[model samples]
Target: MNAEPTTPTTRATDEHLLSIDALAAWIGVSPHTVRKWVTRGPATGLVPRMLRINGQIRFRPDDVRVWLDTKEIQ
Candidate 1:
């Protein structure tokens, strides 16, 4: 009999990549908001930077941190 692995083989560092839902939760917003931000793209100048790999939107931890830092009140 053959068995399938339940867990993925991704590296721990790869976990820092944020999906729309994960980013939304981390940023205290809904997934729809994340999608909207992505849809708006850089035109609005209000969205965090993201990486597009194979057309998938993925937010890097560093980019998210920088964006948040820029938006924070001094």
Candidate 2:
């Protein structure tokens, strides 16, 4: 069976880029914490995988999902 091919529009819609507040809400943290996570160093091991777009910070939903998966403690 042939699956429907994905389009740019569909992919763009599916990959939501979140704001600091939105990401914080999704992860149960405060906006300040999220800001710290993004701005802090590698030592924290809590830096978010984000993009700097036009001087604004943006976080892809997929990146956040992957980060969360990596953080799972055994």
Candidate 3:
């Protein structure tokens, strides 16, 4: 089985995730900007993927750190 964040095996309550607004605040950008990156749709985007907790968007802290690291190097 794929061990993706969206996997049901992983419960949202298992970890403290970052919401779109929180991520935006941390990145010094607007929540709308973060939303755009998450909705890359057909094309690849900044955030690899987002987690859905009770129909709300969430993100893993580790993933955010790695993503920021990659962007810093670029």
Candidate 4:
């Protein structure tokens, strides 16, 4: 399936911010798993840079990519 393009926010265009749902889709995982990474990964170091709009969390797509790239597979 083709992916939907995200409209880059002013602060994140250069950093690649994506919604949690979008990141999960890109990584082939459930959104819950993505959230787990945010809370558990020793190296994730994710902070509040993600903007919350309408009660939903927005994450940097590049951050997600970086996290996945650096994760140690068990």
TM per prediction = 0.71, 0.73, 0.68, 0.46
Candidate 1: residue 64 Cα off by (Å): 0.1
Clashing pairs in 1: none
Residues 1-74, candidate 1: write the lDDT tens digits: 65976776874565467888888998898999889888988557566788888888888887788888988887
TM-score result, candidate 3: 0.68
Query: What TM-score does candidate 2 get on C-alpha atoms?
Result: 0.73
Whole-model alpha-carbon lDDT for candidate 1? 0.81
User: What's every prediction's RMSD, in angstroms?
Assistant: 8.0, 4.7, 7.9, 10.7
Best by TM-score: 2
Error of 1 at 69 (Å): 0.5
lDDT of 4 by residue, 1-74 (tens): 75998776765355555777777788688988778765664354543235567977777666556666655587
Ranking by TM-score: 2, 1, 3, 4
Instruction: Give all candidates' CA lDDT scores.
Output: 0.81, 0.81, 0.77, 0.65
Clashes of each: 0, 0, 0, 4
Kindly list the per-residue Cα lDDT of model 3 for residues 4-74, writing each as its tens digit: 67547654555578999999998899999888887774146577457788999898887778777877754
Cα error, candidate 4, residue 66 (Å) = 2.0
